[model samples]
Target: MSLHEDAVLVLKAYEGRDEQQRALREVYLEHLAEHPDAMYKPCGAGHVTGSALVIDPEGGRVLLTLHKKLGLWLQMGGHCEPGDATLAGAAMREAVEESGIASGLTLLEGGPVRLDRHPIPAPCNWHLDVQYAALAPAGAVAEISEESLDLRWFAYEEVAAVADTSVVELLEATRARLGA
Candidate 1:
């Protein structure tokens, strides 16, 4: 099946635990139904992006990359590629690629932790971000990729100081999921 079909199924099966998430899920479904090209990057107006907040198992820190283009400390994520089978797969692939951890990365048990719709540069107006949480195994080492100016693990408290509001929100949602 195509990524679009897979995304439809994933979204349909997901049961949001909160009213805000439930509303966001509906919006995402509606957006997907309205735009068949929503899963691809070249949609022109905007498109879905998959991202993961990689957390250490101890839950004290998260891996963040200083985005090369935006120059902001953010979670690891990017556009969905043709090879991506599902939104979650795209997020995992991005996490592995950006974090330089080839193995021992596991997604949180629940569905996506949050949905963030944010504006991007021209050629793409917005990124409908499906965010998930990934647990990095003990002793997992991260190497910076070309996409990032720098990559480092930040304490939960430090996230707010360094990252933008979007990243901070993602981190809060991820932490709530971990505690749940």
Candidate 2:
């Protein structure tokens, strides 16, 4: 199946934990149906982005990148590429690419951890982000990518101090999934 078809199926199967998440999923599905370019960056009407919160094996810290353009400490994630097979796979690929840990990073099994809709610069006004959690192996090492100014691991308590509320919320949801 095409990535677009995969996206639609993923969203359709997603069971949101809250009213806001459910609403976001509904709108995302609508956008997908309304715009053929919804899955790509050139959509002009915005597109779905995938992200992963990379947690340490001990569940003590998360790897966050200082986004090159946004200048904010955020999770490892970005636009869905044409080669992606599933939203979760896209998220995991982004995490691996951004974190520089090519192996031993496993996605948290349930599904997406959160949905964050935020505004971006035109021609795309928004990014409807489907967030997932990835567990990094104990020896995982991260290298900085050109897309980020910095890549560092932040303890659960330090996340709120260095990152925005969205990152904090993602962490909370990921931890809840890990039962940490």
Give the winner by TM-score: 2
Q: Residue 117 of model 1: what lDDT?
A: 84
Tens-digit lDDT track for model 2 on 18-131?
Answer: 898899899999999998778779988899999999999485999999999989999999999988888899999999999999889999988898889899998798898999
- Residue-level lDDT of model 1, residues 1-180, one tens digit each, is 899988888788767667777787788888889899999888876788899999995858999999999889999999999889888999999999999999999999887888888888888887888888899998899999999999999988898999998888888887777783
Clashes of each: 0, 0
Worst 10 residues of 2 by lDDT: 35-44
- Model 2 clash pairs? none
Query: By TM-score, how accurate is candidate 1?
Result: 0.94
Model 2's C-alpha root-mean-square deviation from the true structure amounts to 1.0
Off by over 4 Å in 2: 57-59
What value does the lDDT take at residue 91 in candidate 1?
A: 97
